[model samples]
Target: MKLLQRYILGELIRVFGLLVVVLTIMLVFVGLFREATERGLGPVQILQIMPFVVPSMLPFTIPATLLLSVCVVYGRISADLEVIAAKAAGISAMRMLAPAFLFGTVLAVASFGLTNYAIPWAVANIERIVTQAVEDIFIDMLRTQHLVSEPSRGYSITVHDVQNRTLIDATFRFRTHDHHQITVRAEAARIHFDLERQQIELKLRNATYSNPGADSFGDWDGTVLHLPLPPQIHATKARHLTVADLTEKTKEAVLQDEIGQIQQANEAAMLMLTGDFHQFGGKEYSQLKGANAEAVRNQRRFKTEIHSRVAMAFSCLFFTLVGGPFSMLQARRQFITSFIMCFLPILLIYYPVMFLMVNLCKSGTLDPTWSMWVPNGILLIAGAMTLRKVMQH
Candidate 1:
C-alpha cells in the first residue's frame, strides 16, 4: 500500500511541478505585457515587478494546473488497466485515490496560505512600483516642458515656457478631491520646489480661476498654489488588505458611518426646531448618504475578498475530487480527450460563475459569505457524484 501510494504521488507531483512552472511563466509574461502597455513601463521596471506579480497570479493558476496534472496521471493509470490490477489485489477504488486526495489537500492548504498573506503584499507592491514609475515620468515632463498632461489623473497644465524657475502662459486644469474640475490661468508663474514637503508651489501673478458650479475669479494680484508633484499613492482596494486588516477596516467604517448618521440626524432635528424646514436636505444629509454608501461598499468588498480567497484556496482539493475520479472512466483513445472533457467545463463554467458571484458579492446584491462559496459548493457536489459513480463501478 505504501509503495503504491508513493508511486501514484510521485507521478502526480512530477506532472504537477512541470505544469506549474509552464503556467507560471505564461501568466508572468501575460502580466508583464499588460503592465508594460498600461503603464508605459520599460523592461527594467517590468523585470523588477515580475516577482511581485507571481504571487497574486498563483492563486489563479495553481488549481487549474493541479487539475490538469491529476487528469493526465489518473487517466493514464485507468487506461493501462491499473484499476483492474488494484482490485484483483483486493485494494478498493477509494484506496487507489487516497494519495491523490491527500496531495490535493496539501496543495489547497498551501494555496490558502499564499492567498491570505503573500497576495496582499504583492498587490500593494505592484501598485506602488507602477505608480512610482509613472510619477518619475510625470516629474520629468513637468521639468522639461512647461506643460505636463495626464488625462487619466485629470491634470493638464500648459505654461508658455519654463526658464530658471519662471513660467509664462501658465494654465492649470485639474480635478478637485470632490471631483470638481477647476482651471487656473495665470499671466506669469514662479515655480518653487519644496524638498521637505515633497510638493511644488506655483506663485501666480494676474491670475484667473474657474471652478465647477461657481463663477470665475480673475485679475488676482498674486495667488499661491500647491500641487502634489508625484502625488501620494495609496491602495484603497479591499483585496490589498489582509483578513485582519480588512475586518478592522470594515468594522471601523461601519462604526463611523453609524455615528455620522446619528450626528447628522441630531443636527437636522435641531435645525428643524429652529424653523428650518430644509434642514434634512442640507450638507449633513448628503454627507450621511455618502458615508453610508461608502461604508456598505467597503463592508461588502472586504467580505467578498476574504471569502473568495478562502474559497479559491480549497479549489485544489475540489478539483482533485472531480478530476481524479472522472479520469478513471475514460477509454484509451480518450486520454487527451478525457483531459479536455474535464478541464474545459471547469474552465468555462467555474470561472464564469465565480466571476459573477464575486461581482454580485462586491455590489452587495448577494451575501458574500454564502455567495462566494457557491462555486465551491457546486464543485463539491459534482465531485461527490463523480466519486460515487466511480465507486459503484
Candidate 2:
C-alpha cells in the first residue's frame, strides 16, 4: 500500500511540475506583453517585473494543471489495468485514490497561500515597477518632445531645454479645481514624485505666475507646486489588498454606513420636532442617502472579494476530486480525451456559474459567504457520485 501510494504520488508530482512550468511560462509572457503594451513599459521595466509576475500567475495555473495531471496519471494507470490489479489485491478504490486526494489537499492550501499572500506581494511590486516606469516615461517626454500635456490632469508643461534633471525656461499651464486657468514661467525647475501622497512636486526658481481670468500676476523667488499623480499609478482595487486589509476596510465601510444612517436619523428627528416636514426630501438628505448606499456597496464588494479568493483557491481540491474519479471511469478512452471530457464541462459550466454568483454577491443580491462556494459544491456532488460508481464497480 505504501509503495503504491508513493508511485501514484510521484507520477502526479512529475506530471504536475512539468505542466505547471510550461503553463506558467506561457502565461508569464502573455502577462508581460499585456503590461508592456497597456502601460508602455520598456524592456527594463518588463525585466524588473518578470520575477513578481510568476507568483501572480501561479494561483491561476495550479488548479488546472493539477486537474490535467490527475487525468493523465490516473487515466493511464486505470487503462493499464493497474487499478484492477490493486482491487484484486484487496485494496479498496478509496485506498488507491488516497494519494491523489492528499496531493490535492496540499496543493489547495498552497493555492490559497498564493492567492492570499503571494499575489498581494507580487501585485504591489508590479505596481511599483509600473509607477516608476510611468515616471520615467513622463520625464522622457518632457526631455525629448520639450513639451508634455495631460488633459485629464489639466496641466501642460513646455520647456526650452532639459539639462540633466533640470528644466530650463519652463512654462507650466494648468487649470485649478475651481476652474481658474493659470500659467507659471520659471528660469529653472525640477520635478519630484511623492508616491506616498500620490502627488508630483514641481520646484521652481525665479518663477512668475499669471491668472488671466483674475487679471492678476505674481512673482516668487522659488515655490513648489503640487500636482496629482497619473490615474494608472493608483492601486486601490480590493484584489490588491490582503485578506486582513480587506477585513479592516470592510469594517470601516460598514461603520461609515452605520454612522451616516445615524446622522440622517438624528437630522430627520430634529426636522420632525421642529415641524420642518419640507426638509425631509431636501438635497442634503438625498446626498446622505447616496453616501450611505456607496458605503454599503463598498462593504459588499470587499466581502465578495474575500470569499471569492478562498473559494477559487480550494478549486484545486474540488477539481482533483472530480477529475480523478471521472478520469478512471473513462479509462477506455485516451487520457487527453478523458481530460477534455472532464474539463470541457468545467470550462463551460463552472466558470460561468462562478462569475454569475460573484456578480450577484457583489450586487448584494446574495450573501457571498455561501454564494461563492456554489461552484465548488457542484463539483463535490459530482465527484461523490462518480467516486461511488467507481467504488461499486
Candidate 3:
C-alpha cells in the first residue's frame, strides 16, 4: 500500500507538471501570435516582451494545470481499476489517494508565492518591456520621416522626440458628440499617464484647439497648458495597464469614496450638534442632521467593494479542500462531470458569499476580512465532511 501510494502520487505530480509546461507553451505562443496579427504588435517585439508576460499568467496557469491534472490522473486510475485494487487490499481509499492531495497542497502554497511576489514583479516589467519596444519603433519612425502611425480610431501620430515621449507637432480631427467638426493641433506636447490615479494629463506647450466660436481654439496660454483625461477618454489605453494595478486602483478609489462619505457625515453631525442640540428649534440644523444620517447609511453600501478582493484570493484554499474530498467520494465522478459540477457549486457559493460580504460591509455588522472568507469557511467544512466519508469506505 505504501509503494502504491508513492506510485500514484508520483504519477499525479508528473501529469500536473507536464500539463503546466504544455499549457504554458501553448498559451505563450498563441498569445504572441494573436497579438502580432490582431493587436498589431511586432512578432519580434512580443517575443522580447514574453518573459514578463509569462510569469504574470502563473496564478491562473497553476490552478488550471492542477485542476486538469487532478481530473485526468484520478479519472485514468479509476477507469483502469487500479484505485479499486488498492482499496480492496485494505488500504484506506483516501489514504491511497494521498499523493494527489499533497501535490495540490504544494501547488496551493506555490500559487500564493507566485501571486503575491513573482506575478507582481512580472506585471511591473510588462509595462517596462513594452514601453522600451514602442520607444525604439517610434525612434525608427522619426528617422524615416513621413512614417505615420494611425490607430484604428483614425487618430494620426508622429513622434517628434522619442526620448521624452514628446510630440513635435500633432493634429487630431474628429466629430464631437454635438455633431460639430473639431480639430486639435499641439506643438511641443508631452503625454503623462498617471497609473496610480488612473488619470492622464497632457501638458502641451503652444497648444491650440481650433473650431468655430473659440478664441485661439481653447489653447489660450503662452506656450503650454495641461489637458487632463480619465481612462474613458481612450478605451485602448486601458489595455496597456496590468490587471493588478487596475485592481489596486479600484480598491483605492473605493476607499477614498467611503472615507469621503464618512468625513462629510461627521462634519454634518458636528454642525447639527452645534446648531440644534445647543440651540432651540433651529430648522436648518435639523435638516443638516437628517442629511448626515443618510450619509451614514450610504457609507455602509459603498464599503462593500473593499471586502470583495480579499474574498476572491482566499477562496482558493477552500476550493482545494473541497476538490480533495470530491475526488475521493463513492461513485467517483468522471473528469468532465466533476469539472461541470465544480463550477455549479462555485457559482452558487460565490453569489451568496458576495451578498453576505456586501451586507456586512453596508451594516458594519462584521469585519470585512472575516465576512469575505465566509465561502471559504463553508468549503472548508464541506471538505472535512467529504474527507471523513471517503475514509469511512
Which candidate comes out best when scored by TM-score?
2
Off by over 4 Å in 2: 160-170, 184-190, 194-198, 203-210, 215-224, 231-234, 263-287
Per-residue error at 393 for model 1, in Å? 1.3
Global lDDT of each candidate: 0.80, 0.90, 0.59
Model 3 over residues 59-133: C-alpha lDDT tens digits? 666765665666666666666776667778877766765676677666776666665566557655554455455
TM-score for each predicted model, relative to the true structure = 0.79, 0.89, 0.58
lDDT of 1 by residue, 225-307 (tens): 77765444342466667889988988987887788778777877787789787866778667777887787787788888889
Give stretches of model 3 more than 4 Å off.
Answer: 26-40, 79-90, 132-320, 330-367
- Candidate 2 least-lDDT 10 residues: 231-240
lDDT of 2 at 278: 96
TM-score of 1: 0.79
lDDT of 2 at 360: 100
| Per-residue accuracy of model 2 over 161-236 as CA lDDT, tens digit each | 8876788999999999789999999999988777667888889999999999999999955799888888767645
For model 1, what is the C-alpha lDDT against the true structure?
Answer: 0.80
Higher-scoring candidate on lDDT, 1 or 2: 2
**Rank ordering of all candidates by lDDT, starting from the highest:** 2, 1, 3
Candidate 1 vs candidate 2, TM-score winner: 2
